[model samples]
Target: MAESEEELKNLLMKVKEESAKYGLKRNIKKTKIMATGPITSWQIEGDEMEAVRDFTFLGSMITADGDSSHEIKRRLLLGRRAMTCLDSILRSRDVTLPTKVCIVKAMAFPVVMYGSESWTIKKADRRRIYAFELWCWRRLLRIPWTARRSNASILKEISPECSLEGQIVKLRLQYFGHLMRREDSLEKTLMLGKMEGTRRRGRQRTRWLDSVFWVTSMSLTKLREVVEDRGAWRALVHGVTKSRTRLTTIFTIFKEDMSHILSIYLSANAFQHSVVPVQLVTHKQGFRVTLIEQEHEWGGTSACMEEHGLGIWDAHQNAYAVHRNTAWRDRSLTSWMCSCMPTPLVPPASAMCTEDWCGSP
Candidate 1:
């Protein structure tokens, strides 16, 4: 806690003197020193304390560099151990999926998220958190790695209301909000106060407050004002986390559907003599694009334009379209066909037609 080694020595001596008066002895063997810059050796009563890179304190890993990567890795390892302990319960066929999910939520998640409220999450940390969550789900479902099930598919099956990363987000925001509303204290001062020193050259590392700013998408001043109203702050946190979960689900489904569609179209034997039109269908869950083969009886000529990657011909317009660099936003059948079709293949203005293929134009 001291700014310099001399000050720290003085504070340690004062503590030792005060404790001796109370018939208490400091455990020199249990003491360790960590520094952000250079490591320094310290002696107390002719016993030198150990200097270490990182150590665990109160169930969380503390590193001199202030990076949470090691802490996150340790947490994941602990979570896996917890999962292993519950393997019999999770793998039991008699246990309902809901019951198993409840067990995991109650047991595994807490261990993984023990000290997440203080984590300065980075992109890599987020990925690790997500992977650990999926690992837990796979273990509960007894899904082997050889099954080739995607993370999205597993998440869809689980349909969790909140993801691990989302929970971390909620906790970080809640902690920040709590600190913002508190009176003067050591934690608050350390979080919000500035220290004297010139920062080292190069890019600055992500801080805990930076993670808060990212999750809330609000500047520090605005966050301070909003956090004053506890009700409003809670609502905001809930809404943000909920929206993130919803968007993640939607995007996962969309990506999986797109991949399926691409695989179907890209297969070498996808088309033979007939040209099949893929129909894009929307449902409550997500988009579904089905590629079914059908005979083209009124066709002038059938050409499987595999070079374009995606080929669609309008039966009514008598024109063929090649899908190259086309955006997915254009949903109308005719508009999509015409806009994507090359200049030479585009139908005449008189023959152009607007048709709804995906149920909406």
Candidate 2:
């Protein structure tokens, strides 16, 4: 832990020096330490007395009710409200609500500057994963639409949909804020593009693109070809900026990536029900592939290969073991590297029966 802290301090110091060149200053106190696990809201029962007692206990623990009694009270109030808000959120069909909240909480450092806003975790020990997520959501709720999109990196890592949703929200905010000149509006309209794609096979993954071109060219087949072109990938992201339709189109690609990764389990005929965390790693030097096999009953093995073109059949067999390729394609047939061998390590115990149970991060 000491070595880790020292390493972090050195990394931060380096970042500070680098930022000085751009006249941008970073306050370490405002930075968030990355956390692992997911978040969920527990069902609160036992009526009003139980709620008040729960609130009082949490309030007393975080605050002494002295010189900063008001601050303490405020945190308690915020926690209560977050709990209530979480309850309302639970009523919805979305399971990612807690995770979205966690992202916002993780960004609390920036939101605090907005004033009068605060957050606190009650019964954090009960479920740190969901609690942290809720903390994020509360902070996000308080962020102005325009400013929210500024944290694109954080949004992509946390909730891509919310990040894209925020981009749309920002446009509406700017238009209403009187900051949208006619040219600015036109520019915004033209910028409506999706922010996701598939990695190129024998490359990383593949994503669908070209909705903007489709809209402009009025040709569906041409649009799909252009979007899937590996050479134009970076250019496409720069072109589209504000359209929800474009964003949805991109999200569809993102979902496609998830679907491809998850398909491994379905093909293997292993545990029919399982949630596997997928990671797509790209190296600057060149493409490398390594597969880790786990022994959990509920868990299953995964096979991934880089492919180009949106279609799975277009991928080259050289990218992955021929026996493993199910629905993926490869870009460079000669450059394919397969890491389909199972790891020697053993998997952890069986996962909890409930889908809400978050395994090791």
Best by lDDT: 1
State, as a TM-score between 0 and 1, how close model 2 is to the true structure: 0.18
lDDT of 2 by residue, 6-39 (tens): 5755676688789999999875334434212221
List candidate 1 segments past 4 Å from native.
195-201, 246-361
My TM-score estimates for the predictions, one after another, are 0.68, 0.18
Cα-based lDDT at residue 316, candidate 1: 33
For all candidates, the clash counts are 0, 37
The candidate that wins on TM-score is: 1
Error of 1 at 350 (Å): 18
Clashes of 2: 37
TM-score of 1: 0.68
The list of candidate 2 runs beyond 4 A from truth reads 1-161, 164-169, 172-178, 182-361
Candidate 1 residue-wise lDDT, 1-361, digit = tens: 7878788788889989999999999999888888776767777668899888898999999998888999999999999999999999987889899899989989999998999998887878877887798789998899998998866577668977777777778888899888989998888998998869999899988988887876665899999899999898988887656534411211111334365323221211111223344433332233433323233222322232232233443423322333323323345443432222232222223322243111211
